[model samples]
Target: MDAPQEARDADVSAIAALDEPTRRRLYDHVVRQSDPVSRDEAATALGLARQTAAFHLDRLADESLLDVVYERRSGRAGPGAGRPAKLYRRSAKQVAVSLPDRRYELAGRLLAQAVEESAATGEPVRTVLHRKAEELGTQLGEQDDNTGVLDLLERYGFEPRREGDAITLANCPFHALARAHTETVCGMNLHLLRGMLHGLGEETLTARLAPTPDRCCVRLDPGA
Candidate 1:
């Protein structure tokens, strides 16, 4: 699935936050240390005012580039150890952006799951692949908080558009693979949408193959 615009925007903002020279330097220092660095330690190491170090570190934490923890550095017992000092460390969050919406990760996941399941059960690879795709689509549809099918499709980057009584999927989420293995990928696409329609209780709509030069391989048509 294509990463949501809001997520990509947040990632971009987080990366932009590090553009400040002092902040970037402070971040570099914090990540280099094996243990989390306290504000006072970072301030001394960077030759900055204590308050200035705190502010930049807090900003990094706010953007989720740094994680915050509390520790008592004095190595003493209750009430004598003094208050816990706030510390900073590199966050585990990963931020990535790709132009034109690459979903190689999702495709790889589906392919890997298909291979594993097929090996375990001795099922045909194609059958396992389609089943896995359909299951994933159903999970996606079920996660919809009562939104309509079109909304769900749009959220997952199917780019649904109306045409008379049907909804045309404008962008294929599996574009690269679809182009390479048209029949196999298109068949999986068809079943995935079918499962999505079922999960949404979409009695008035159905997914069908209606390939065109400019649009996705699947279309949603009115059910009889």
Candidate 2:
């Protein structure tokens, strides 16, 4: 329903498309070529039947792992010229998957925004970073549906686990960056969760920095 989920599903589908040997072979050959490949050429190069290659190439294009383009092989452009040949090439879409999920791109965007805005407004980078991260978290919270805070947290790869009345995040979505830049990143994370709760209209839980082994630096405590 959300972007992360949608992306994961698409990437999984694309990866699954390659699990078939013939499809994978066609995909590899197409990408390695300097130009888009025609079905006949692909089949000849791979020593596969034309029908077999065409089927696999179509499958790759369906999954968006390959892009299809129609171009005439002949240099002539007259009425008598044959129709354009359908060709296959690599798609520009990027695919990534992590065991525990990660949001490095999100952090990078926040950090970049902080630096650029700090330069423009003469505000401290740290101040801008926190503001931007919180704004983003709020935006995430404001998306469609009335999902619970736990659900929202999990969706964002926080891996939130309940401990009595409190919540501990078992995984940090920005783990590597947070480890490299603890103070700045942890502060950004704290404000992010704070704004998330604010946007979700959650008043009973407080997000605080409570670093622990093998978990996030921020913890959600219940009540005022």
TM-score leader? 2
Extract clashing residue pairs from model 1.
Answer: none
Question: What lDDT tens digits, residue by residue, belong to model 1 across residues 1-224?
Answer: 33476787888898898899999999999999999999999999999999999999999999999999998888886967899889999999787766555566777888899899899999998999888888887887777556688788877678899988999998888888999999988888888888888778788888989999868899999974
lDDT of 2 by residue, 124-161 (tens): 99999999989988887788458789989988899999
What lDDT score belongs to each candidate, Candidate 1 first?
0.87, 0.91
Candidate 1 off by > 4 Å: 1-12, 19-21, 98-103, 180-184
Error at 122, model 1, angstroms? 0.7
- Whole-structure CA lDDT of model 2: 0.91
Per-candidate clashes, comma-separated: 0, 0
Against the hidden reference, what TM-scores do the models get? 0.81, 0.93
How many Å off is the CA of 18 in candidate 2? 2.2
